[model samples]
Target: MTTLPSSTRRKLGLVIDLDTCVGCHACVVSCKGWNTENYGAPLSDQDPYGAEPSGTFLNRVHSYEVQPDDGTAQLVHFPKSCLHCDNAPCVTVCPTGASYKRQEDGIVLVNEDTCIGCGLCAWACPYGAREMDAAAKVMKKCTLCVDRIYNENLPEVDRVPACVRTCPSNARHFGDLADPDSDVSQLVAARGGMDLMPEQGTAPVNKYLPPRLKDRLDRTEEIDVLAPFLAPVTDQPKGFLGWLDKALDKI
Candidate 1:
């Protein structure tokens, strides 16, 4: 039988559209579902029914309220996940060689068998993408559904990652960033895409398109225009001598 082509040269990454994402939590939920059941042990939750319950998750959506100078608030739902940085610091920090970037596809992955549970890679990740699977004592993170994406048995539509397949708003795209003609690249070019925390200089392969400006809400109407110019009124006396004379006049 002929040998299958290796995945070493392919470039893989995620594209998130801030303009279209409604912060519905579909991607987050779907990611949890796929990862929990498929790879290593289900994300390993601690104290599920307790007061401070938490679980390991590769993807999380954060909600931010941005307040403008006029006291207007905008609710921005930003999803936080591994951007799979081109210069991934996590890979270099791993002493066991468990964390590595695929030369063929540019996908960062952990070799579960070789991982020693040192937790160094997790500390190297600034996005908090890597989590220790407490049950397995190994680090876990987004694989980008590697198993599903390359499965020859699945239909073309089903070949993408579970998270991308389940996104209802179509806010996520997965493809090769190396090729400019790819759909993800086109979308990024059409929109002014940017990397989050570029100063960190991880060179995140993933890109986020900022949201379009919404209709302006008028806050000027809420403030009384004459309030600053209007004088303060008081029933009390002024200066001592003038007050006495004014009181005598009034009486």
Candidate 2:
């Protein structure tokens, strides 16, 4: 039903830079602002004015404290969202065909119009990336901002997703994962990056590169373990020697 070329397969994906990321919430805010307005459904809060308030988010930054057995502590902030995997389980589990991946750019998109309000997609996801749209009564997830990225009117740099554009630390990246020579691909190759929950065999196209940490011994606290023996000043006369011993004790 489409007229695009067969070789026009878009290898749509995200490349998050762990080196430059400062764990700022700028990307989170930018994603919420853009997707909630232009996308198919807006992320809404159930009881915004009530005691408990929660909203659907396509992107969330999670901060974790990692401690080594050698009494070393480290802070790790990980931002979680849909990986748009090559073997995406969310698409296969959808009974109504609402959840589908774009053949054009390899982006996972949800068709709210065809969705039957079933939460099957959410359960199938291992990353907890999908969230239900309370207002639309359907499952909602990241679209990679297809509407904005492909628009010819916007500048080339701004053509990327909102999250990538608004990142203060420039942590988020947008590019084609299939391209071995792409910026994202080159960065991953050089940085020794890693993926999240790789054990699930999802083969997620989106990769997570953990922040490099300093060595443990660099911060180890040093203290003198052995005490030096000192001569007994008790037998000395009650003069300069006694006073010196008292001063040493005070020292």
* Candidate closest to the true structure, highest lDDT: 1
Native-referenced Cα lDDT, model 2 = 0.80
* Shift in Å, residue 63, candidate 1: 0.6
lDDT of each: 0.82, 0.80
* Candidate 2, residue 47: lDDT: 93
Q: After superposition, how far is residue 142 of candidate 1 from its true place, in Å?
A: 0.6
Poorest lDDT segment (10 consecutive residues) of candidate 2: 1-10
What TM-score would each prediction reach against the true structure?
0.80, 0.82
Residue-wise lDDT of candidate 2 within 1-251, one digit each (tens)?
11112332766878787656778888888889998899787888789899998888999988888787766787777787899887788888888777887777778888898888778889989999999988878888988888889889989888999999998887888899888889888877877767778888777878777677665565434332332334354666578877988888898
RMSD per candidate (Å) reads 8.3, 6.8
Clashes in model 1: which pairs?
8-104, 8-105, 9-104, 10-104, 10-105
Flag regions of model 2 displaced more than 4 Å. Answer: 1-8, 215-251
